[model samples]
Target: MVTDRRSEFEATLTRTAEARGQEAGAALQRASLLRDAIHRFIRNRAAVVAAVAFVVMVGFVILTPWLSHGSAYGVDFAQAYKSPSWAHPFGTDEFGRDLLVRTALGGRVSIAIGFAATIAIMIVGILYGAISGFAGGRIDDMLMRFLDALYGLPYLPFAIITLAIFGTVNFWTMVVALTIASWFTTARVMRGQIITLKENDYVRAANALGARWYRVLFRHLLPNTLGVILIFVFLELPGVVLGEAFLSFIGLGISPPKASWGTLAQDGYSAYEAHPYIIIIPSLAIAWLILSAFFVADGLRDALDPRTRET
Candidate 1:
């Protein structure tokens, strides 16, 4: 009887231990899922760096007007063309204006233009492409052909002609010029994505169920293509900023009294011999902005690409 009781007790203990083992295994699985999510995010170091840089730069630019000492437009011929010194950090420009102040304010214009042009470009591209791609057949061909014709026009030549005809490159004019040329690339990308997505099983099911065309495209297609669109937006921003600069440099960008990085660089060119800081400072700002954008874009590419998803 003693031996039988001992065996029974051992069996009960074994069952309890087995139950505890199962509970521990379940806990481990939960922890593993959490770990996997964290690992996925941490794996993309480039993206993290880019994101951080962008945030810092953006914060700096937003606070620029308040951070400057003298007015961006305030001129002092007395301090004209001063080199970098304690009184003038980035020195004075040809017109005796503070280079640092102007550069700081210039950040607002450059960043604003980038965001404005991109938003406009994306809106037009997404709408036109979504419609054309959903319609398909002759409608798609016709729309694409029209876009192709527009694309064939040289951007520089057209910009020059418009500037000459307008006789002034104002803020709105710059936006218009950029908008005309920028949307084509986005439209093409969106259309291609839409084309592939329309034939997807879910899309087909939605169609079969008599779902509205707009609903199908906007609700289903747009979300899937969002990653691609975001990637393109980051990739294309530098180009827009550079284009704005080019126009400003050539006297076809923002008019004087309204400083842009490009126009500022142009202004500093004549006095670069005496005030190297004037040129160097603006040039460096532009470089940093472009480089930061590129880094953020690269990071987005890695993060968004399916091939690198596992990494």
Candidate 2:
């Protein structure tokens, strides 16, 4: 009986050592992958430049309100339609509001909407997809069919309807509208990924070991989908920004006394013929942000690809 007990203790020790070894190996592999991804991202010059530009742009918007001498809302009729000068580098709009300050402030609103809406999309999409994929059978079919029904709805119109329902045109309102309209695609992508990942050996082993559903889903499945999720995030940002801009341009987004790149464009449109800088400046800002985001997304895609070699 003593010999048997000793053997059982030895087996337990062996099992514990193997488990530790596996955990250590996984940690090492994750570190190596992260290191390689960073190296790959750094090698992409366009991505590096774009990233720097994006950060600079974000900082410029965040700090502009504090640093600018002029107010975004304050009007000075005497300064109206002035060309780019030392006092106002981006010149003044028709109302003599400083274009530079307006542009910067508008950026804050636009970028904020983009990030907020994207975050909502990620949470809703990831959870819905994971649950549907993991559950499968009738539930999967029902959820997918509902998603398909949503897919048939037009994006802009749906957002507009949602906005109308909220009875306001503000930051949170716009975020909700965009989030409601945008989560469908993300959900589809995540669902496809989860469906494949759920069949992997690690996931099966997790189930076999009696791990809870949430643990298997969150700890095991979700982590594996990070690369795909990150790529989608960068790619989605530009779209959300543009969408916000479009809504604001149509007067359905940010209202008067507040600004967004889209609203700035709209304000500048009529006066563009007389003072092209009004429209040109904001348009260029929008283009710059979109291009930068796209480059970063491209870099992330290549970096995270397992097939990508160090060469």
Number of the predicted model whose TM-score against the real structure is largest:
2
Q: What would the TM-score be for candidate 1 when compared with the true structure? A: 0.83
Clash total of candidate 1: 0
Model 1 / residue 190 / CA error / Å = 0.5
Query: What's the count of clashing pairs in each model shown?
Result: 0, 0
Highest lDDT: give the candidate number: 2
For 157-248, candidate 1 gives per-residue lDDT tens digits of 77677667766777777776777778888998899999998887666756755678988888767877876787778877877888888888
lDDT computed for candidate 2: 0.89
Clashing pairs in 1: none
RMSD values for the candidates in order, in angstroms, are: 12.3, 2.4
lDDT of 2 at 129: 90
Worst lDDT run of 10 residues, candidate 2, spans 15-24
Q: Against the true structure, what is each candidate's TM-score? A: 0.83, 0.92
Residue 231 of model 1, lDDT score: 78
The clash tally of candidate 2 reads 0
Residue pairs whose backbone atoms clash in candidate 2: none
